[model samples]
Target chain A: MIYVKELCKTFRVARRDGGMKNTLKSFFHREYTEIHALDHLNFTIGEGEMVGYIGPNGAGKSSTVKVLSGILVPDSGICTVGGRVPWKERTAHVAQIGVVFGQRSQLWWDVPVIDTFTLLRDIYSVPETIYRRNLDELTEMLGLSQLLRTPTRQLSLGQRMRCEIAASLIHDPKILFLDEPTIGLDAVSKIAVRDFIKARNRERGTTVILTTHDMQDIEALTERILLIGRGRILRDGSLDALKREYMTERHMTVLCAGLDADTLSLPAGMTLSESHPDRAVFSLDTTVLPVSDAIAAVSAQTDIYDLSVENPSLDTLITHLYKEYEVG
Target chain B: MKQFKKVPAHRLYGTFFSMHLRAAMEYKSSFLMSFFGMTLTSLASFFAIWLLFDRFHTVDGYTLSEVLLCYSVILMGFSVSEIFLRGFDTFAGQVQSGSFDRLLLRPRSLLFSVLVSRMEFARTGRFLQGILVTAYAVTHADIVWTPARAGAYLLMLLGCCVFFSSLLILQAGVCFFTIEGLEVMNIFSHGGKELGSYPLDIYGSRPLILFFTFLVPLACAQYYPFLYLTGRADCGLYALTPLWTLAFLLVCIGVWRIGVRKYQSTGS
Candidate 1:
């Protein structure tokens, strides 16, 4: 279980102007700006829960991860993992958690992947039997058998990412914190990672807090989403709830074979997004007009061959949330 | 069901050293070239001193072999510390590259992790050269080989290692305050070796001797111990002067601890 209440963190950034004159000026008297990276955030994640932490760049996502992982001490906050303060009991807290930074390589560059894993086994003081069991299962699950013998630098990005995930889980951490875990992998690699994460959460009951820009990763792996923007928790709900709350408009696309020439007239509050001789797309706001009425109105104007109705995608839903919250 | 036990620090360090040695040996050609290159460069310094002595039989009542003893001890201390403490020497770059963040994520001591992340095996070339110089000096230097004198010599070598390691740690601690490394710290590390190559008395400067004796404690490791070994100072306490270097190591570690706390708070 994890509980964070009113956590706040601020960073002081030095300001300097360009060119020799300003650079010399800064040498004498430098300006500084205070950035509130985490401003009074409150969230609690229950055991065996998989939550996606979503935010734009500079949105304090990584800052939150660092604080939870015991890498950074916040200025003022009450954050605890199963009653232990991460920053205060760093070594013990870190031993019970796993972290994967997608942009960084935790494995040694020149050494074989197995060497890094073995080193971590000792570093974490995992029992030999548990180490062997985890190694076997992870190797088979991640398809890292042959790749383990090769140096990490030689592996492709996809293969390296798999090893990175496996490396973090060698100690069988109870809580897994993934910062952009599926950042740059190909489709297959991404699916493999997501499936593994989902399976691990289901089977092992590992508490996963993932932060990623890839919406599909959130959709595939997490049922709950926590949207953060401008150092504040903007929204927290299920994927279905987000769709229902933001899906005031429904998009209907019609594939009509022969109806043409500026003929069809849509009902009030419905707008045509795209139009062609063979196909047309219309946006309907459900609050103003019913879905049944929109269907009848479209059928009255043109001979409808094929029609499909859908809500906005996760990408559009998030964009709408960002706009509603007025966060960049 | 079982009590958790962390790996002993010494055992973990041993594993780190073995892994580093293995990694270094992976690049056989580069390792050999640098190893030989260091020995050759260090040999050049010895010849420089030898050439100066060839022209003048004694500088400040110290013969050529006596100077070699001092030079070789400093060389051994410098190279030995470099072998183990090169991690701190390169700590600033690690912090910049965010590798220091990776180090902090682990459930181990940050200082130990940094110390183990790097080990300069190539510097063995300098260490070997120092050993050779010590062998040459021991046979030639005119001194009675008392057990206390031999102990003083070994202690002086250890002191030199600790003293240089302290300098490296101090520099690393400074990196926490300024992410950009201070290159000026090298003046003390490299300059101390150069200054310690000769008898401290030859400087003929009281402030210089005192500075080395108390601040960096380089002269305590070389000069006071050398006085006892050469029978110049009859005091038994001079043989124990290298103990001061241990005190210097303690101070360095204390500063390094403060830096670690600062890093956790600042998160830079």
Candidate 2:
């Protein structure tokens, strides 16, 4: 339901040297440096697809979201959300999309959360029946019934984030753009948000484009992943495909009754990463030697008391990917 | 299937207005303090005008009531616009805080959204003061009130409101480019209200009168209409000169549109 091609946005930022004399000189002749916030970015998201947009800081993730959500006009590119150019037909295009900026709020402060919802209802021209239905459903799902009456400024951060999500969904937008929705949330709140998003995607088929630094959020909520860096899309594929490519090494931790310290010989595919009195951590290249073979090889030298083999976590794989792309 | 009925702009604005009222009511003590404070400050300015009239019985060949009439018209117009157009007055804050991005995400006119985002009901203090002064002027000024004069008076108030509102909009449009409100803009918005308190011709300068008459159109709402209202001008067309403020409104909207298209939202 979203198509973007050759999207480019450059920002001219003012620069000035420190010290009073330089400041005075620069005031008369200001200098600027152009930063490419988005550079020929291209991606297509299908309907009902929840995609994780992962990138490091200043990677143009938020810039891309702004362009698609009609908040920023790109210098040059063609972007159509559900067949409407966002910046060209903003009022019409925004009606079909919901956006939640985790760091920013859309709810009115010093007023009950419900007041903002009703204002949004009127703003989007949602039908009374639909508004009621959506409000009831969101209240139940987000556990907002108790919090709706509280002023936004009085609510805790997690409570406010839930209300922010509900406010965005009041109009039942077909597409949802969540920029770092799980940031600054406790574990329980994060899981609650992730579960609600997953359920919403499953039940209502809402297309979700989520950008978050939390790898667990990506692992739990999205099937497809779009990795961007330096204002360009570096990788775009299914999460499992990325895992398959980056998960070639398996970490093996073995607790053994070690009788020798420096006299042990290891196989070519297995390298001991860490060693202790009775425990040893091995990094095994599973492509060269399978997990079973690696375990058997370790068992030959030491009396194994306990053993565990694990694939690297998603966080490690992302860090590895970022390093591979030289984005960090 | 039930049809989704579209809410009219007026009803939506009413919703916003009532919400602002409720929000303001939350801080009753602060609201009252500011309301009275605003009244007293405006009264001080009116007191200055009263002292001037007392010292000079007729300044520029106009009676005290005539000057009071001009002052009240400008004062009432300014207060009305300040009450309703406060969003534009404080728009730089919205842009700086990135809240303006939220407005663009809604399915409504950006101008309408911004217009309803804020309202300074506290300015009703100045509005009431204007009414009191207008009442005193009407009772004391010797002028025949015909239907045309009444119409001219009503149009003058409306034109003045539009004139000030356009100035606020112009300043708000400038915020998109500069990202901060220019203090120089206050010279026109606040300064015009002070200068317009007296009839433009009383300024005794041709360029000053022409600047307000054609360039900014402040005199169109005050001077020309005041001339027709007081029977000083026989031409019926002077009464309609207040309509020129509409042209200024169009120009401001054009600038605002350009600003919106060129908007570069700050932060993520």
Candidate 3:
């Protein structure tokens, strides 16, 4: 559904120093530095795939989304979505794609959400029958039947985000480009949004390219992850592949009431430290020391109340990706 | 199963106007206040002349009625442009808020979307007052009412509307290139309305008249047409000078296209 090759975008940013004198000097003679927002970026997202596009701030994530959505024409390279170039065939290309910029709304501020949706139906030329069907489905699924009649300004952030999602889907677009959809949502709202997105992908075969700071969103929805930093696509592979590569050490905690920590039979490459009277922490190279063997060693030494092995969080892995990549 | 689908330009325009009407309805008090305020405020322009003629009895050799005819036409032209083309008038807001991006994303023409996104009903009341003032001017004027003369007045009104709208469009279009909207464009747009409220001849001719005539064609729509309407002009060609406003308008659209190209290239 999407194909991009060597997609490079450069912006000429005027360079100016701070302070009143420097600002005045800039008015007389300004210097500009060329910033490569996206450099030799390449990725292919197939139909019906929900991929999380995550990176640190100013990592060119929004730039990539803008380019793909035809909002910005790239300086170089070819980006094709559904066999049409985004910038070259914007009308036709955009007709098939839905974009929701979390910071900017597509709906009119003074009007009700439904009014904006109705206008969008006309703008997109969606058939009346199809518009009704989609509106009904999206409204009910997003729990937005009540919110539709309310003015956009009156909606809460969570409520408005739902409306934003619904607004984008009014055209029944095949591909959705969500730029930070879950940016400032509560945990419940975030999960609900994730569930709704997953359901959309499952039922309609909608292709979703989501850019977000929340790694949990990636863990929940996308099997594949695309990491970008400093205008470069550093990693592109499945989530487990990334987890295995960066997160080599696994930790386990055993909870035992009134147990001697030294009695724990530690694995060869493992060290046990008492965190609490009931809890002990052990480290193991997940590749060499199987989690079950380490757990068996602990259970043999102490009467276990409860125990669990935990993989490093997706957040930790992503933070490592950020530091390793040194996202500008 | 449908062979084809389309909304005719007239129908599209109807939809745009109705949507704006609905939007205006939502702001009932603001709409009503502005509507009343525009009518009263626009009347002040005529009162300036009414007070002047009260003192002097004439501007140059033109009487109150003749100058009223000129002011009415200019006011009518400006009010109509502002009413329908307000989207262009406030294009800076659209660009700054990024609503312009939403406009470009639609399948329809970007120009049409900008026009539809905003339509000020308040100016319609002002336009009605201007039209009424012009009608009063026509009753008092000495021109013989031939069908051709009637046609000329209607055509002149239309040509002036297009000309003013074109200026506003040209102003908005320049915002694309600069990434910032310039307020000075209003000098040509809003300022033109104020300037056209009188006989350009009173400002003296020299090269300015030639510049406004052959270049911008403001004189065509106002000065020459006013001369013909007031019996000062003898040639039939003078009656048709209002048509030059259309050509002048097309040039503005051309400039607008270049600005759009720059906007796409820079994408700032």
Q: DockQ (Cα-based) per candidate?
A: 0.73, 0.62, 0.48
* Cα RMSD, each candidate: 1.7, 2.0, 2.6
lDDT (Cα, tens digit) per residue for candidate 3, span B148-254: 67766776687678878888888887887766778787777777788788888877766878877887777788888677777787687877988888887788788
The numbered model that scores best in TM-score is: 1
Q: Residues A58-108, candidate 1, lDDT per residue (tens digit)?
A: 888999998899988989979999679998998888888999999988898
What is the full ranking by DockQ, best candidate first?
Answer: 1, 2, 3
| lDDT (10s digit) by residue, model 2, range A164-231 | 99999998889999989989999999999999999999999999999999999999999999999989
Q: What C-alpha lDDT do the candidate models reach, one value each? A: 0.90, 0.90, 0.82
- DockQ, computed on Cα atoms, for candidate 2: 0.62
Q: Residue A208 of candidate 2: its Cα lDDT?
A: 99
* Model 2 clash number: 0
After superposition, the stretches of candidate 1 with alpha carbons farther than 4 Å from their true spots are: A257-263, A290-292, B1-3
Q: Which of candidates 2 and 3 is the stronger one according to DockQ?
A: 2
lDDT string for model 2 (B1-268, tens) is 1235779999999999999998888889999999999999999989988899899888888888998989988998899889999999999999889888888888899999999989998888999999999899878887798999989988898899999999999999988888889998899989999998888888799999989988999999999989998999979899999899999999998998788877844332
Chain B TM-score for the candidates in order: 0.96, 0.96, 0.94
Q: lDDT per residue, candidate 1, B92-195, as tens digits?
A: 99888888888888899887888898999999999998899999999999999988899999999999999999999999998988888888888889999999
Docking quality level of the chain pair in candidate 1: medium
